[model samples]
Target: MTSLLPRTRTMFPGLTEWFDAAWPFGERNLVRIEEVAAEGEYVVRAELPGFDPEKDVHVAAENGMLTISAERQARKEEKGRSEFRYGSFSRTVALPRGAETAKIAATYHDGILEVKVPVAQTEATGQIEIPVKKD
Candidate 1:
């Protein structure tokens, strides 16, 4: 009944504090997303609960990169050991080679933000034709 990793906080207090300061929440500000390939299109789904899609979410595509960002403010009511995350979160991912940037669309439903990117499907024939020239 022991941990595999060493207890760094106890061994090196100052070092652990510095590491904590450098990354306050350690992946807390990163928006969790999943990329999927659908029929003739690419899809990206982001988990973003407790946020208004109209005002709190923003999506943009530029230079073959798609960016999804959201912001949620902390509540002002009294709290007793709450674990909800707040503040701004963003994630950027590369678009597929044939993704149509202009025709991209997004929708939010049931605490999930889904972005659909139209992409041209490419098929491989597994055989290549090479031309030979006489030396």
Candidate 2:
């Protein structure tokens, strides 16, 4: 997709890319994720800088919903002007259809979390017969 910013020099070029946000001198607490499907599976990659997996982050998958949450402690005190950072953050990404939720796996490494779910085999042996009469 071509960015509008390249075509026109609008006042707010970043408006089109608002999801790529920055706050408080480039410090952000929002969790960002990128997902891709390849090799009969979908892999989701998320970034949570300066967060501990053992104590700070929680990952869960249920009913085709994937949730990633984290809580970070306040680091340093701002004297004059401070952009208050959020302590806790949660990002829920809906899994694509046919995701094998029962075989999902997640791991965190170097501030990046990767979750993988294989695509379920979708096949129909025969059509179901529906009766007009109700039981």
Candidate 3:
């Protein structure tokens, strides 16, 4: 003779729903970003906690666009145990009309990445030449 037991799905339907809602598609976390503009420069700030300066952070500019990217490893204790995983993030912004690319610079301090983009100077207005035509 054999005995039958209750199915696992029937026992914990609500728990399944809660787990699904908490981590849909098992996404770990989201990165925060912020940008600001100041006189003669455009500043971009990104939050990158617990990242190495030499290995994780990178910045570049090409064709009037500036890109900032970084990768931060999650805490070792929680890497494989929890569903929360933190990975790399890349963000890019288009340079303004008068923004200078050659003079761009960046610095990272206290888990914050700061990029300084110099604004281009405008030329002084000159007299216009108009041709005379017979009516």
Model 1 poorest 10 in a row by lDDT: 13-22
TM-score for candidate 3, please give it: 0.61
- lDDT tens digits, residue span 1-135, model 3: 111333264585445444534244554224456778877888888777777867988989998898877776767673355644477877778887688888888888998888899997677679988999989
Q: Model 2, range 20-109, lDDT digits (tens) per residue?
A: 445324634378889898857989888987788889989888888988898888767666654444589888888878888889888999
Query: How do the candidates rank by lDDT, highest first?
Result: 1, 2, 3
Give the C-alpha miss distance for residue 2 in model 3, angstroms. 53
Q: Which stretches of candidate 2 lie over 4 Å from their true place?
A: 1-29, 75-84, 124-135
Candidate 1 lDDT, 1-135, residue by residue in tens: 233445454675445434534255455434779999888899999999888999999999999999999998988867575546688889999999889999999999999999999998778669898999999
Name the best candidate (by lDDT): 1
Better of 1 and 2 by TM-score: 1
- Per TM-score, the best of the predicted structures is 1
TM-score-based ranking: 1, 2, 3
Residue 34 accuracy (lDDT) in model 2: 92
TM-score per candidate, in order? 0.69, 0.62, 0.61
